[model samples]
Target: MQETRVAVAGTSFPAVRQHLEEMLPGAVVEAVPVELLRSGGCAAEVLVPAMCRIDAAVIDRVDGLRLIHQWGAGLDGVDIEAASRRGVLVANVPAGVGGNAESVAEWCVMAAIAVNRRLPVLQRVLRSGAAWGDPPGRSLHGRTAGIVGLGGIGQALALRLRPFGMRVLGVRRREDAELAGRLGLAWIGGAAQLPELLRQSDCLFLCLPLTEATRRLIDERALALLPAGACVVNAGRGGVVDQAALVRALESGRLGGAALDVFEQEPLDPASPLADRPDVLATPHIAGVTDSSYRGIARRVIENIHRLHDGRPLLDCVNADPAGAQASRDS
Candidate 1:
């Protein structure tokens, strides 16, 4: 039997390769760094774009590519239309399925608190031996927290924040009163109500994906809607907020601070102005990179691979009909 080839386009290659090999002894998994993959040097039956962007050109370069499986829920980086045109299947492990949502929710909650308390400034003060009470911070209690994108992660965060005595407000693409009631959110509204949400939020959390409609959704005008000294926390795709607008708001003292886990650009430029600011708390996009999430994600990936081998329909396929694709391949 010929060995099945799998190419991984992000970090944790060794661990993923080992796991897949152990489970499917006849499969050959190799790491194809994003740089190499972009330069048209990938040849595999399955492509796992863990943290890499798979565009139309890169997809065309990979010979015999059948599947483009994302390690987590965010498939914004993949060009689903292009993959479907080439008869390739694209799928992702949904946020809540792999503990990814819970992990990210925890990170968002921590970030919200950190920015609210001005943690970065406190760290600097401690190191500089400045006055102990020079930079007083506010408490989460009795403050309004507006969560955009009421998906798995947003819903998880809402539930977690309620215990902190926060008045949680959620905005989804559509309104879900039942969900709001279940999560104990003070109120829930649709996207059109974003301006209302912003005006009331003491701390705003962005947890939506990046798309045409969402790119820079929180621009200068939107930032102007926020109450002065309000903090911002972003665990979603970086492009959802305008970096320049955020910087201006922070610099002009219009906004309190920001905590960011994801950036518009990966491997954020070291010399970027946002890097060393005391008011900005930055993390390198590891919100959902926990052991619990990875284990569950790996199991799902393996299951899809096995399904592909057996001519069975793949799970969570976003583009292309899985059953039809499998049948076409068999024929």
Candidate 2:
């Protein structure tokens, strides 16, 4: 029996190695740092990357690489075209994994409430020894929350927010009446109804993917549509919102506040103006990263490894080049 070799790039998550070891007894899992990935030192048949930009150059270095398993749902960093051309299948553990969706939804809700309650302002005042009641706060009860995507994460968030007596509105690329009805959404529609959602929502949550259509989906015009002093919580990809426009809105006080887990440039520049604003809450992109989520993702990866060992198709295979994938499998 040949030992399965897995290379984990970019992240230093100990759980990944431990899980792979316990699940695949003879598997060799190497932790490849970001520097090695950048310099093209990935030598493995299976590559699992977390927050590492897997471009054409990196792919070229790994000769026997057959799979690119993303550690999470976000795949904006992976070059799907390059992987497809190189006959490497790309897979991701989507939000359907209960833990991942729930974690992200919880984070989104926390962001919304934190921003609306003016937590940042209160913290600033407390630290500066100023009057405690300088900034008035608001509550989510009876307010409307517009979710930009009606996917698993959005639905989870809606379920969590309902207990607070909040009205949830969702918009997706395609309208699903049954899903909306099941979720008990106030209203759900396609992109055409986004303007209405913006106008009505007291708090807006962005949960959409980062595609060409969704890139900069929340720009100046969209921000202007929001009712004054509206709060924005973005747990989706950073590129989905126009950073410059968002900064302008925050700086000019056109928008009340924002809580962002993702940014246009990750590890957001220390000198970035958005980092300094009292009304803006910036966090390292960690909405979907939790202990339970990692365990769930590990199970998926283990399942895929079993399938690969048995010469069967992998789960959640995003880049489907049947002929090419088959060739790689055979090799």
Error of 2 at 204 (Å): 0.6
Pick out the ten consecutive residues of candidate 2 with the lowest summed lDDT. 321-330
Extract clashing residue pairs from model 2: none
Backbone clash tally for model 1?
0
Return the clash pairs for model 1, or none.
Answer: none
Distance from true location, Cα of 108 in model 2, Å: 0.6
lDDT tens per residue, model 1, 1-331: 3578998876643566666677667888888877778776677989988567899988987998999998788898899999988888898898878788999999998888888788998999999988898688889999999999988889889989999999999999888899989999988999999999999999999989888999999999999999998999999999999999999999999999999988888878999878989889999888887777777888898888877777788889887464765667744
Q: What TM-score would each prediction reach against the true structure?
A: 0.93, 0.93
> lDDT values of the candidates?
0.87, 0.84
